[model samples]
Target: MFLIVKSLMLVLMILMVLILVLNLCSMKTFYDKEKNSPFECGFDPKSNSRTPFSLQFFLIAIIFLIFDVEIALLLPIIKTYNMDNITLIITSNFFIIILLLGLIHEWNQGALNWLK
Candidate 1:
């Protein structure tokens, strides 16, 4: 057991030394000029940065995130379905219903309205 532990420690030390050498070999001079420069994309920073964003864009983004997270929550339900679990199916439906009710409430409250 002591021999095995010592061998493992030796292997780890050699790997660490090799990693340090490789990192030093790959190091580049990152100066302030390179760091502060706008990226090489043809986009002009002055004009695009001042433009006002549309509310419709934000609303769609929020809805997309909400639904995206809902899909994340559904992954477990899918696993449960594969395992033939009825309780998980019912629980998943309950979560979907709650999301739908919240969406309806937001719609009624004009939170989801773009033209208001």
Candidate 2:
């Protein structure tokens, strides 16, 4: 315990010293114009950086990400279920039901429709 505490203190001191050195070295002079401007190779930019985005597309992407993550989460539960854990199975089932209900709600609300 003594050695562990000593080592941790040493690590903390080293980190503190490094952070101080970095803070001292990272000061920048006033050069905001160059920092804010886009880099131009020999040619000019064809289009503006800030373009209008479709809300529908964004919604679909968010839904896809949510479901994709849910699928990944479900996979681990599935692997664990093979070990014959009854409580986990019921919990997983409840979780799936909730997901299905959410999906149904979205479907009813026309969120799944592409043209909406």
Which candidate comes out best when scored by lDDT?
2
For residue 65, model 1's alpha carbon misses the true position, in angstroms, by: 0.6
C-alpha local distance difference test of each model: 0.78, 0.81
* TM-score, one value per model: 0.49, 0.53
Write model 1 residue lDDT over 1-116, tens digit each, in one string: 99999999999999999999998997566676765668734545656675666778677688879878987887777765654567767888899898899789878877677686
Residue 96, model 2: lDDT of 94
Clashes of each: 0, 0
Task: Quote the positional error of residue 4 for candidate 1 in Å.
Answer: 28
Give, for candidate 1, the lowest lDDT window spanning 10 residues.
39-48
What is the Cα-based TM-score of model 2?
0.53
